[model samples]
Target: MDLKLVILFLFPVVIGSLGNLSLLCHSVFLYCSGHRSRSIDVIVRHLTVANTLFLLSRGIPQIMAAFGKQDFLNNVGCKLVFYLQVTAKGVSVSTTCMLSVFQAITISPRSCGWAELKLKAAKHIGRSVIMFWVLHMLLNIRVPIIVSDKRNNTNIMNIIDFQYCSVMISSKEKTTTFVALTLSHDILCLKLMIWSSSSMIFILYRHKKRTQHIHHSSISSRASPETRASQSILILVCTFVSFYALSSLMYVWFSLYIKAAWWLVKTSALTNAGFPTVSPFILMTREQFVCESTRKK
Candidate 1:
């Protein structure tokens, strides 16, 4: 129950939870206001929910362990918490990737092939969200068998501790299978996000050239709305990639290193929470910009 660890978990837990709650509230309000719902409105709702779950699952146990609660979670608790944490994290990545792709399609040229995607994408949001959850849940279904409260368990051949819960990798083969599955999940989502970001940037560049050619000058005395929207999505996607990559690198380093570094685990956990902690504010910025523009009108 180190005071430092308590303080570490508290910042992300308290601040991230509040920010995500606000974002969720704002999203729900917009949806129920009787006006047409934007694709982003739906995406934000799902994203915020996943972020909140991730923060809670990852944060609360650390906080409890910091408070000197030994064996605070039983075997069942470990399984449930670990399962929720990973599943929610997977959903967050997938949803953010979807957001970037949706934005790219939203801003793409009407005559371009992306236009057809726009028509189909909106209709599939609900189904996509369901698929993400189901896929991750099924993929990680082995979590329950592998995770247990350390105090209640006798076997400790290869245990990965998370302060309150421990994961027992029974054999090298199962470990390899688990790592492969998780890596595949993350790589696919990240690739889509990178592709979408590149497409958006290309589209924005072409737009800038068009405007400049028309005016024969440096365009944008003020940036266009489409430009502004694209910037927001770019920021969100880039931020997620930066934080997620750093956290993942730490994970890989830990796995490869011989001696266990509990400090490194704590650092990785904090870095892992970075996107969920920062994303709500990033999403809020777009609304602030939109509000300012509307008032100017």
Candidate 2:
């Protein structure tokens, strides 16, 4: 591979892996040190694991391919890598939506409907996490069945084509069905995230106004940890939406013109890796635990 392509593929791997690993380690340290863990911490820890897996599964193979290491992965290898990548992506999306909803519930007033969910939500966090994994795994089972290494195929013809992996769809009907299902799933998750984030923002705005009217000068004092965390969650949601939109547009273009230019594919891959690469740093900046841990060390 050329220097540019190598850097393009490897940068996300290094940054994302290191950042997420650090988050995971810090979360573990907090748990071991008897720092009472919040629900957000549990979700963030899971998010870090999913992001780390995403970086490894999605970034490494692309980097290897960029370096002209075509034969490094075989049919089974492609299946596993793509399967894990898709599954991790699904987990990431679902977990983010859950985080948004959880935060909204956390910050909602006692008289609100969201407040009613708080106790039930807290109790089901573990089960919900497990369900996210299981549901994504089941949904993406077709990935392994359809994906195969593209290294040895010289005269391949297909409805959909990829460089490192080929997805074999036998019929247009099946292709449409798969695409529709995937799109529907993504749309549902995105809608939930947007709704939850917007609700949180509105709630925060109302609270700020109410506080200002009540205390006139205690506005700064009203900025609780929950408020800070909500802002961070909003930033995270916006970041994910921006990157997801760009990557999805590229994907649509690729689908329409399967023989898209090489640079377009690289850009798509980079954008696909963008969220996982940057999300940990956003959390690190917003969360106090990371800073406190650094100070202690």
Q: Each candidate: what lDDT?
A: 0.85, 0.81
Off by over 4 Å in 1: 213-219, 257-259, 290-297
Q: Estimate each model's TM-score.
A: 0.92, 0.90
Q: What is candidate 2's CA lDDT for residue 38?
A: 70
lDDT of 1 by residue, 95-165 (tens): 99999988888888897566778878988988888898899899889888878998855657567777788
Q: Give a tens-digit lDDT track for model 2, residues 9-69.
A: 8999999999999988988998899877776778888889999999899888778777877
What's the lDDT for residue 165 in model 1? 85
List per-candidate RMSD values in Å: 2.3, 3.1
Worst 10 residues of 2 by lDDT: 288-297
| Candidate topping lDDT | 1
